[model samples]
Structures are given as structure tokens and as C-alpha cells.
Target: MSDVTVPPAPEGLPYVSVVVPVHNDTARLRLCLQALAAQDYPADRFEVWVVDNNSDDDPRPALPEDERFQLLRERRRGSYAARNRALPHARGEVFAFTDSDCLPHPDWLSSGVRALLREPRPDAVGGAIRIFFDHGTVPTSGPEHFEAINEFRQRKYVEEWSFAATANLFVDAPVLSRLGGFDATLQSGGDLDFGTRLGRAGGRLIYDDDTVVDHPARSTWRELGRKTVRVANGIADRSAHLGRRDALARAVNEGSGAVTIWLKVWRRNEPAPRRAVEKVRYAAAFAYVRLLRTGVHLGRFTRGR
Candidate 1:
């Protein structure tokens, strides 16, 4: 997208700065804003920053003209790029990040801020995420869906294995500035890379089980494919940057493992077999592209013209 740049922090700091990066999804974006507005935290203590990532849709009409919210648009393509655009404008001691589609519980801000504040200068803190789905249209309690959603819940909150997603993570300005902010080059794995760097730099990462947000699963086959492709590209880009042979191998193995689990679900049970099969096929194709991209990326990296 664009080169990574960090601007000077705003003059005065607030209690917490909530940043939500949005593209063109106005409807879902509105829902997320509504959830934030309903937060239990005192409205005067927190400010919301919405970064519009080059949306073709004119979002002004969708947004209510208000002083509490600031809408900034970046012409860049990636969410990380847009995050950089908004980072300079943040005036909170701790910056809380979430996607436009994610909905937070009323206590999300209070709990998350408390988690970060309670720690002895932790670099970042992450909360739990639950999938929210439309009732009757799809069963949220389905085994496959529930398992996928609960995967994060089952993870140990140990410091050694501490990794946080940007969707539910809060970071201090010092750590963010030290880490040079999220890598704008990464398509999807920037969050993991940032966490890894923070870990390497002796930055403490914590997981707070009490803090939670609702992230929705992809509802349609098209969205599932799009997400898979982006994820594969991220793996390829990450492997290339690291210049490690095993990185690509691990990506392939993990990608295949996902396929195998989906296949078992499709063959053994899913009520919608056709849709399941289609998703599996799309995932396989995405995995194959990742493999191919790895090869091409390695070649370019090695040549280094």
C-alpha cells in the first residue's frame, strides 16, 4: 500500500482510544459504532476513531455528524496501512483496536482497559472473542462452528505463548511507537508479526479472559473464499520476509490441516454438504496459491535485483 509512517501523538491523551478500521461495509460498520456508543465506560473518558480505508462509498451520509467520533480516510489498500493513518491522531494512553464488523460487550472497554492497567507495564493485552451469528438463519451451536469459534477460548494465557489479534488487543503508545507500529507491508499477519516482535523485545503480552468481543464468522461462500485467499497471501508474504524455508512448510501443513478438518465435517455430518464441499474446494485452491506464491516470493528474494 504505502510506506509505514507514524505521526506525533495528539497533544493531550484520553483514558482510552478505540480505533475501528472500516472499508466499504457501512451496515456492519454502523452496528460496530453503535456497540461502541453503548459502552459502559464514561463517554467523556474515551474517544472513537474510525479509519475509512479508501472506501468508494461516501461514508459521511452514514455517519452522524458528531464531535465524539472522528472519521479519517486513507487512500491505502490494507487495513494495517489505514491503522498507521489513524495512529498519529490517537490521544489515549492505551489504544484499543477492533475491526468494523466486530461487536463489543458493554463492559468490553472497561474490562480491557483494566486488564492493561492492572499489569506491570504490559506491552499489550488481548481479550476473548465469541462469534455472533443471526439466529434461525444459521445455527451458532453447530459443532463445527462452535469449535472454530471456541478455538481461541481454549488457548492457554501463558506468557510464553502470548499472541494477540488486533481485533481484540489493546496496546500502550510506548510499545506501539517502539515497535514502529504495525508493518504496513503485511496483508493479514501484521498482528502476529507485531506480537512476535514485541515478545522478542521483552514486551509483556497478556491475555485477559474477562474482556470479550463478538466477532462474526463469514456467512457466505464468497466471503469465505476471499478471506482464505487473503490469509494464504499473508502466509506467503510472511515466509518471504523471514527468509526461512520452514516457514512455507509450516504454512502448508497448517493450511492442509484446516482442509482435512473441514473434509471430515463435510463427509461425516454437515447438513449443507454442497456448500461445505465448495468451501473446502476454495480453501484447497487458496492453499495451492500460497504454495505457488511462496516459490515465486523465494525466487524474488534470492535474486534481490
Candidate 2:
């Protein structure tokens, strides 16, 4: 079937397990739950699994008292680990992954499942994500602007790198089991690693621009800083199996390239000075992330020295 509006079927629909991993971000998680609850998909065909990854406070109370939603906790302290905790318990033909802070479209599940059920079925599907700001029409802060230009380019990631962010990804349940699920050691970029493995295993991956979700942008420098550190550390962890030096070099180069990439794709038609200001904001954020990555690699390399 082509990418068209998929209608709800009365019977023969496959079961779906929607998995989410959340930390202390309760406010946004509430919205995410509401979105899931409002899905157009039949309740009996889909189940929601919200795995709390050792939040500072138990998120059980946050979960609505509904049988369709189950509360699972993973003390291992990572989103991927929390997801793994739900893997064995997930009783579905398809596994849908989304972030705790994401507001998936009402048709998200139906569209994803429809794509998977096509004649030449895909092993995985990467959906579209729209980055949203809490206040103002445009980004109000440096972090928000930086994220606006850099984050949630899921389309580019899927088409160029053959990987999809877990914020809106769907995969056949058996494919995940065959690949041994996500690498639990990674705190970030787990989606990329998992998707790359799928590609290498000759698994068919599809990019569906119609399947959509909304993710809130980071509004504060501190929030962006924390994310930068987490991602950099994840890169360090992944480099342990692959050569650390090579990965570290790649990270450094990617950071430098981010500056140029932003300039080329950003508002170029604007007055030169205004465009320059935007470039500065993007450069500052990219520099901070680069420095954090360097520190992480140095720390990992000099462990006992």
C-alpha cells in the first residue's frame, strides 16, 4: 500500500505495543499520555507501556488509572534499559517507540502499522517529528534557536544515515528480538545504533513523512547543556567497542561541520547582520557540545592515569 490515509479496520488488525521511557519530566509526560489515550486506533488492539527509568519520584501516580496503560519501572537508569524491561512483557506484533515528552498524532499508530503491513513490508519505519516552542512564534532563547535549527531532523537522519530516532519509530517485534533489542549501555543515540544494526542486517527501513509527532524544544541553556553532555557521554560509551580515537575524531569534525551546515540552511535571505546573529547563537551551542564531547573522550581515555 502507498502512503495514503489508512482507514480503521474492524478485524485482522495486528496488536501493537507503544513503549515510552520517562525520567523526572512529569509535566510533558502527562500530555504524552493524553495523546496516546486519544489515538484513533482501537483500544483493544494496542497497549501502552510507560517505563519509568528510576525517576526521582515514582511516576506511577502520574499514570492514569487505565487498564490499557501499564506502569513498568527499570532501576537500571537509562531509557534504553527501561525499554528493554518492557520488551519481554510486550505482547504485540509491532513495537512503537516514542518519547515521554512527545505528543503523537491521533493517526500515529494507525499510519505506522499500515506502513508495516504493506506488500513489501518494511522491518522498521521512521516517522516525522515537529519541534514546538512553548512561548512566542519564533524561538525566544539561544538554546531554542539552536534546537530549532539542529534537532529533530528525522527525515534527514532516515534518508541519509538509515537510522531513526525513537521519538517516533515503529518496528516489527520479531526484528527487535533478532537484533537483541537496543544496546542498553547507551544513554543517547541508542536509536541510531539500533537502526544502523537493522540496516546492516538487511532489514528494510521506510521513512514515512505522514506519520507525525510533536516534541517540545529545550528553552533554557542549562537544559540544552545537560542534553549535550548526555549525548557526548553516550558517544564515548559507544566508542569503547569501536575505536575511541576514530569516534572522537568523528565527533570533533561533526561539531565543526554543524556551524557551516546551520549557516547554509538557516535564513540566508534575511539582512546580513540578523543572519550573522543567528549564526553566532548556533555556533555557541555547537561549541559547547564540542567541548563537552572532548572532555568526555579525555576522561574515558585517561581512566587510571
Candidate 3:
């Protein structure tokens, strides 16, 4: 997308309310706030609502002195619930969602807003999620390599699956309102439900590769394992609501996906010893995750409506 220089008048530009949800992550929240402060978008044209999702540590200190960054709190347990808490307070015509763990590019807001205002306007925009490692270290771990390659494919998610992770998504305020905001009950995959609802409602959604944010990849089995459970639970949780047939099909499909785990590692160009070890590690992790998912699906099935 070409650079559409912001006109001198603040009123002419898109007024965006950037909403972020934080848990017990004050350390990364500080970085997220700092990045938001440094955005190329006109400071006056955008406001950020960082909802402290019941953090044990006080994140208020991470809040900038500027009034543009409002600090709010939600007693809710899930991120989507916390996001719903900010809906009533959003003042922007557009709402941009990112996680506290992300470092949004300086042009993130501008590129997203610009894309939203294009000639054939889309009701929502899903941007690129660039994954990075901690401290610029050499990508050593198998979990890291697998996650870096597989995680956060926002464009593919938007085009094929009809949703983008909240880690980097921009949707119009009215469209969000029309859909009744995100599903607060979900432990994960609220973005999937919301985006799917948007498409079903005839809303236009598009992908803008330039609109990007850097998300840290899960480097350990522990971290990625938690994500796996959440993702599995999220998928089953949503699918269960659709009925037993759909839920069973989803479980089978995910179970079948285990075969592709080998392909991901095999496709990578790496040294032999390292590749072999990585493949084993990836297989182990995938199996562990599949086990967790299977358990969750069984529980959901047992508790069927």
C-alpha cells in the first residue's frame, strides 16, 4: 500500500481506538505501551485503551503520562471478556486489537487505518504477524523453530479461515457493535467467531500485508503446550456449540493434522543432526498437545447440550 500522508487536519484522519488486553504481563505491557506511544499515526487521532485483565501486578505504572492512553481494569478471566469491557468506552470509528505481548510497528496504526479507508473499503482488516525470538538469540530450540514457522499466519487465517488473531486485527467500530463485540465466554478463538460472524453478515474483510506487528514466538514446550490446550479447547468449545456432528468432525480433523507435523519439519532446510532432533521434538510436542486436545474434546462431548 502506498503511503497516504496524513493531512494536516486531525479531523480528516481516522479516529482509532486501539484496544489491548493484558494479564500478569506488566514487563511486556510496558513495551507494548511504549510502541503505541511511538506510533506514526497522529497522537490526537488515536486513543489506546489498555485493559488490565485482572493482573496480579499493577500495570498502572506502565501507563504513559499522556491522557491518550487510558488505563482500565476488568475482573474477567478471559481476554475476550476483558476486551468486551472496553467496548462501551471506545471512542474511535475503528477499533484495533493487539495483545500486550506484541510490539506493533510504528506504522501499524497508519497502515491499518489507511487500508480501512481505501476506495473499496473493507469492514475489517487483518494484518501481518511477524514472529521474533527473545533477545535476538540464535533460533536454537525445536519448539521455537516450529512455532516461528507455524504461528500467527494472519493473512492465511483471514483468507482461508475467515478470522485473524486479536494479536493484530483492525475492525470498524460499527461492525463490531453490530456483531455485539467479541464472545466473552470463550477462553480462546473469539476472533474466529467474530470474523466468521462478520463475513456471514456480509461485511467485507481484507488482508493488508504492510500492516504488521511483531509477536514473540513460543520457545518452550511449556509455553507452546499451554497454547495448544487453549487452541484445542477454543476450537472444540466453538464447535461443540455447533452440535455433536460438527464437534466430532473437528476433533477428527485436528487428530488427523498430526501427520502434517512431520511435513513442517521435513520441508525446512536445515542440517541433518539438527533437523532429526527437531523432528523428534516437534513430534513429541504435537502428540502431547493432541492428547490435551483430545481430553478437552471428550469433556466437551460428555457435557453436550
Candidate 4:
């Protein structure tokens, strides 16, 4: 990891609210909080709000005991809902969001704030994400390798689709409030939906490559499959809102796109002979994930019908 130095904020720097929603992830949340505490940004200029989203385990103890770090509880089941619950209470001009399982670089907040203050300021900004596997150089499992490769495509989401993952997004407070926050009903894809809405409303969303966070790769196929289904369901839910014709059109588009992705994965060549086995493993994992996603989408379509 490259070293990040956060310089002192200029006078009149905007106060930032860093919001994180957590479910039953105590250990990972602690690590995330520790990283936040180590941020080189002016300590008094930023605050952290950790919303416990109906976690069975108490997350309070895991959080740092600092006035800047406040813990809020949201009885609602979804992360988006938790974020909504805390949105009204945020006392900052900018809102920086990240997942509890992510470890952000020390300069993450500083960079995001700077991006938001640029001349042609954007309504929202998304940062880069890097995946780290528990098992050193090679991934320990198929799901791990798959996640390592595809976890957060921040650049593509921002440039191509005008969306960004909430895992590392920064938004101006007024724009976020005006947009009425994320769709609370969504379990996944809420960030995408929010960004899309913002763009449609004449808001600009930019991608800043400097702000960075590290996310651990998913370790099991079951976990990966569950996430895949949740994401597919979120996408389907959005399509279903547009009526039957739109839903059908989305299905057709996605189906063709999936086929193209599969073909690319199958034909990808690994020039290094020693890493050939690793390449095969990645291809199989990618194919499996694509198939699972297709099945999940099909199930959603059937249920919608």
C-alpha cells in the first residue's frame, strides 16, 4: 500500500460526516473504526457515525470511545435504511460513506473533501477500492478469487453508468438531502439507483482515483451466491418499478450482456505458464458467478410475473 499524507485542512474547510452502517460484523467493524481513528485529517473537522442496522450483536463496544465517533441504532433491516436514519442527524456539509468491513486509507477523507471542493464541484464523488485476500498471494477459495477481481468497479460505474458504490462515495449534503437519500427498500443497488437519480436530476457524479479503501474478498461460494442474488433482486426491483415492458427489455439486455461477458472470460489467455492453473481457477469462478447471477435474475423475473 502506498503511504498517504493528509495535510492540514485550509481555513473554512467544510466539516465532513463519515457514515458507516453495520450488521453483525464486530471484528471487521473494529478494524474499520481503528483506521478511521488514524486518519490524518483534522480530527475536529470530521465525525464518524456508525449506524447499527439491527445487528444481533451489539456494535457499540467495538467502536472507539471518542466524542467524534457516535453510534446510532436503526431498527430497520437494511443498510440504506440505517443510513437514512442517520442522514438527518449528520452535521456536515459533506457526507462520506463507506462499509463497516472496509479499511480506508488515512487520506481517504481528505481526498474526498478536496474533490468535493474543486472548481467544477460534482454532486457526488466515488473512490477506488482494492481487494485483499486473507491467504497471501493466491486466493484461498474460488469465491475469494472471484471477489478479488470483481468486488468494486468504481471507475466503470461512475464513467459509464453515472453511479458509484456506497462503499467509498462522498456526496454534498444538500444534494443528498434533495435527492431524499437512498431507496430504503433496496438491499443492494441503492447506491446505483441514487446515483442514477442524481444524474437524471442534473447532478454530476465524479470518480476520484485517489481516495482508496481495502475490502476483504468473500471467502465462500455460499456467501458470494447470496450477495449475487441480493444484487440481482435489487436490479430486478428497479426494473419492475418501470412496468412489464421495461422489465422485459431489461431482461433481454442483461441476458445478452451476460453472454458476452462469459465469452470474454472463456477466451482470456494467461501468458505466464506458472500462473496457468490460477487463470483456469479464475475463469471457472467467473463462469460460476455469472451462471448463478443469471439464475437469480430469472428467479426474480418469475416472481415478478
- The global C-alpha lDDT for each of the candidates, from Candidate 1 onward, is 0.69, 0.82, 0.82, 0.81
**Candidates ranked, most accurate by TM-score first:** 3, 4, 2, 1
Full-model lDDT, candidate 2: 0.82
Candidate 4 backbone clash number: 0
Give a tens-digit lDDT track for model 1, residues 95-162: 89888888888999888878887737577888887765555434343333432432345135334456
Q: Write the per-residue lDDT of candidate 4 for residues 1-305, one digit (tens) a residue.
A: 00222244578677888999999998999999999999988888888999999898999888888998999999877899998887877787789999999999999999888888887988889999888888786576767767766778899889998899999999998899889998998888899889889988999999999999998888887888788778877777767666656655656665665455444554536221135565555656666666666665666566764
Q: What is candidate 1's TM-score against the reference?
A: 0.75
Runs in model 3 deviating more than 4 A are 1-11, 135-138, 242-274, 302-305
TM-score of 2: 0.87
TM-scores, one per candidate: 0.75, 0.87, 0.88, 0.87
Residue 119 error for model 4, in Å? 1.4
Model 3 residue 54 lDDT? 82
- By summed lDDT, the worst window of 10 consecutive residues in model 3 runs over 1-10
